[model samples]
Target: MGFQLTADGFAKTIDALKEHYLIYAPVLKKGTGRFTDTDIVRYDFVNEASEIELERKSDYAFKEFLTPLSETLLFFTEDQVKAADIPDKPVLIFLRSCDLHAVRRQDDMYLNNGWTPDWFFKRRRDLVKFVLIGCKKSYQNCFCVSMGSNRSEDGYVFSVETDGDGFACDVPDTGFVPFFAAGQAADIKPSYVTKNDFEVRVPDQVPGAILKHALWDEYSSRCIGCGRCNYVCPTCTCYTMQDIFYHENGKVGERRRVAAACMVDGFTNVAGGGEYRKSQGERMRYRVLHKISDHKKRFGENMCIGCGRCDDACPEYISYSNILNKVTDAVENLGKEVQ
Candidate 1:
């Protein structure tokens, strides 16, 4: 069923949910960008619905709420150790369709990859519920439609869309019925993007021979290795763990997991000072192949969600979309020669 909520009613409903759930949504943080002269869009805990930013795509994804930029895994002392405590409250997250798909990818890596589930990720995943924020138009760099991540029915508890003077929300899950009782019932359908300014068509098969191909060298000078691409991507899950020691007692403190980017220095470093990818071109090759072929070969889907945040976050303006097109052409030519 669906319901119509006035702006005020929507705020009240979110306030009500605050009693049971910690709400995380994309928010506008004014004067926080690089120059401190522009507004930045990032996920933040919201107490009321008014705090949510629905008009724009966040510069980063909602993954921070789950994986977090940095989080304590455990606390340790000379003789004793304790696991980090999980919050008692549940979590409610608002995300768009592409980001919701990104969550599934993270779940596949953290929860389903190993014999046992990741307790840290699972603990938060189990307590969280998703609310889809309707997308009516495509953003500047977004290619979600091209990646077939424009809509999803199973991940969200409900969806919210703006209509004239009120919000039209559809509650597919019966458990969410209680939340919309205060609003007027209406027949509303969720909005999704049917078209985008950009499109990416990955080849049906990408040969492993492309690994040795020199196509990626174009990025050697263009890429500054700032690592912004992975930082803004919703599906980039690589992380580095750290242990912080107390000043008074070197053996006491906490171990933490901090997000890591493959493009950054020391990512491929080894014990003997050897690095797997010494050049920026090689690093770029590994990243592109992993997103377009390697990950899909194992997971049956591309790791790149086509959210286009990588393109937007690039200081050198490297486009993952363009790289895919080049790879597609190379793979097709390689196929022809073999045949």
Candidate 2:
């Protein structure tokens, strides 16, 4: 069902939903941007309709609610171990079409990649639902059209977009229909970006020789190994475990699963002081290939949903989309060399 709601009606609807679901949406955070005196739009819990930043593309992805940057998996004592408690309240996350597609990538990694689903991730995933935030226009650095993630027809309870002085919603899930009962019924379809400012061409296959390609060397000098890209990427799921011990006792502590980035140093560190992919170039190569090529080999689809948060987060201004094109060019060049 579709509905056309007045601003007040929408606010009331949000108010009613709050009674049951923990709503999260993009919020304008003042003075919290990378630059001084700037604002950034990122995901945060919202209690009302007015709190959601609907005009801008979120600087961060909604993946944090599902796969937090730092999550306590379990608490441990000298002789006892207990899993950390998760909140029983269900969650509702508002996100765009690209991010909706990114959720599939996340599901493939945590729920389907291995023999057993991650218990911690599954618990959170089960409690969560999605709300599609319709994209009226393409944002800067976005290539969702090329990635085929600019439109999401399903996977959300409802789809919402700004309409005049109010909102238009397509409530596919019958369970949520009553929330918008006050609104006027209408035939509403969520808006989607049909095109982006630019396009990215991912090669069908990336050859092994591309690993030694000169394209990666540029990133070695240009990239400072900040790892901001991995942090912002909705699909990057790498994590490292930490055993946090109390100062008074060593055995009693909590084991945390902290987000990890392959671009950063010490990520490859192992026993006996050994480290793999020592250079930033090698790290860059690994990350790029994994996004465009390696992941598809395993999951039958590219991991990158092309939301371009990595481009937005990179302090060094390295363009991941450009790197993907470079990889494509290198693949073509390698084909010529083989011929």
TM-score of 2: 0.98
In candidate 1, what are the lDDT values of residues 228-288, reduced to their tens digit?
9988888888999899998676899999999998888889988998888877888899898
* Residues forming the 10-long window of minimal summed lDDT in candidate 1: 33-42
Which candidate should be chosen as best, given lDDT against the real structure?
2
Which pairs of residues have clashing backbones in candidate 1? none
Tally clashing residue pairs in candidate 1.
0
Best model per TM-score:
2
Model 2: residue 301 alpha-carbon error in angstroms: 0.6
Q: Give the alpha carbon lDDT tens digit for every residue of 1-339 in model 2.
A: 899999999999999999999999999999999899999999999987899988899998898888899999999998999999987899999999999999999999999988999889999999999999988999999999999899988999998899999999999999999999779999989999888897999999888899889999998799999899999899999999999998576999999999999999999999999999999999999999998888999998899998988998999999999999989988998999899
Error of 2 at 220 (Å): 0.9
- Candidate 1 segments exceeding 4 Å error: 247-250
Off by over 4 Å in 2: 247-249
